[model samples]
Target: MALAIAVGLLLASGTAAADRVPLPALVKAHRGEACVEPLPVIRRDHMKFLMHQRDDTVHEGIRGARHSLVGCIDCHAAKDDAGRWVRIDAPGQFCASCHEYVSVTIDCFGCHAALPTVAFRKTAE
Candidate 1:
């Protein structure tokens, strides 16, 4: 009976890992610089898998957070220092720049938004 239970648990665990979309390697590839490609669109089912991995309840609010409506480049792409949108290097500025135009206060930066190099120094840490 114990052997059967262990087998069941192992199968369940394997099924869970198979559901999530692997995060793009590009996001972390450039030394934690912003991703060059659009962030992969993780589906709702995959998000549910992630919440389950965290042992959290699958609430509607949590699911909403999981749905990917846009890719990172949709928000981050901008004119570069070389006068081209494709070459923009500063990524945090990508989000911040738009928020300013929209007249919205960006609180995410208050805790989370430092260039990757300064992320370790964040007070939230």
Candidate 2:
């Protein structure tokens, strides 16, 4: 009876550990210029920045600000091994990986194009 209880406890602990969320696979950003804000600031308040940028663009007739969504797509979008452009919000890609990690369902790509108009050549490693 003691052996059975020990085995049950061990199994329960293992199951609990396995239920923890694993670290997300973040995409490596490839950008020509530095980001609009520091990494820590951007990580904490990016949604607020994006919302403000959208308001300026739609209501104030402003466009192409540093915080614009198009700027983000241009910097974060990547290419596959085949050299074809990959969507920023694709699985394991830039936007999707982080949003999915936090259990957030985003509709940013529903209206916006995921690919950047400017084509970037992968730098030679």
Candidate 3:
């Protein structure tokens, strides 16, 4: 009976550990030391910031490079092993990896481009 109980405990603990799998490492930014804000701040409030920025751009015709989605794609999008530019929604890329880990579905790419705009790309170059 004692041996059976010990085996059950071990199995339960193993299951718990499996349920607590660590999050994948975040992909690196293409420029600078970190994101626009501190890591924790961005992790928590990025959607809020993005929403506000989007409203301003779409309704008010105000555009700011620092907070625009184009800025994000320009800095976060990276080249894959084959030298092709990876989209933000690609697995292990900037946006997809974190969104996948958190189980959040982003619909921004449904209408907006996931890659940076041509003007942004040229300016980056």
lDDT of 1 by residue, 1-125 (tens): 99999999999999998896343222222233444333443322433444453343234334222222222333334443564334213433554443444454634334432333223344522
For TM-score, candidate 2 versus 3, the one ahead is 2
Cα lDDT for residue 74, model 1? Answer: 36
Runs in model 1 lying further than 4 Å from the true structure: 1-92, 117-125
Error of 2 at 122 (Å): 17
Best by TM-score: 2
Where does candidate 3 stray beyond 4 Å? 1-21, 118-124
Per-residue lDDT of model 2, residues 20-96, tens digit only: 75658777777756678998798889999999999999999899898999989888888899977799988889888
Give all candidates' CA lDDT scores: 0.40, 0.85, 0.81
Between which residue pairs do clashes occur in model 1? Answer: 80-84
Candidate 2: Cα lDDT at 121: 43
Instruction: Tell how far residue 54 is off in model 1, in angstroms.
Output: 12
lDDT of 3 at 7: 100
TM values, all candidates: 0.25, 0.75, 0.74
**Global fold similarity of model 2 (TM-score):** 0.75
The 10-residue segment with the lowest total lDDT in model 1: 63-72
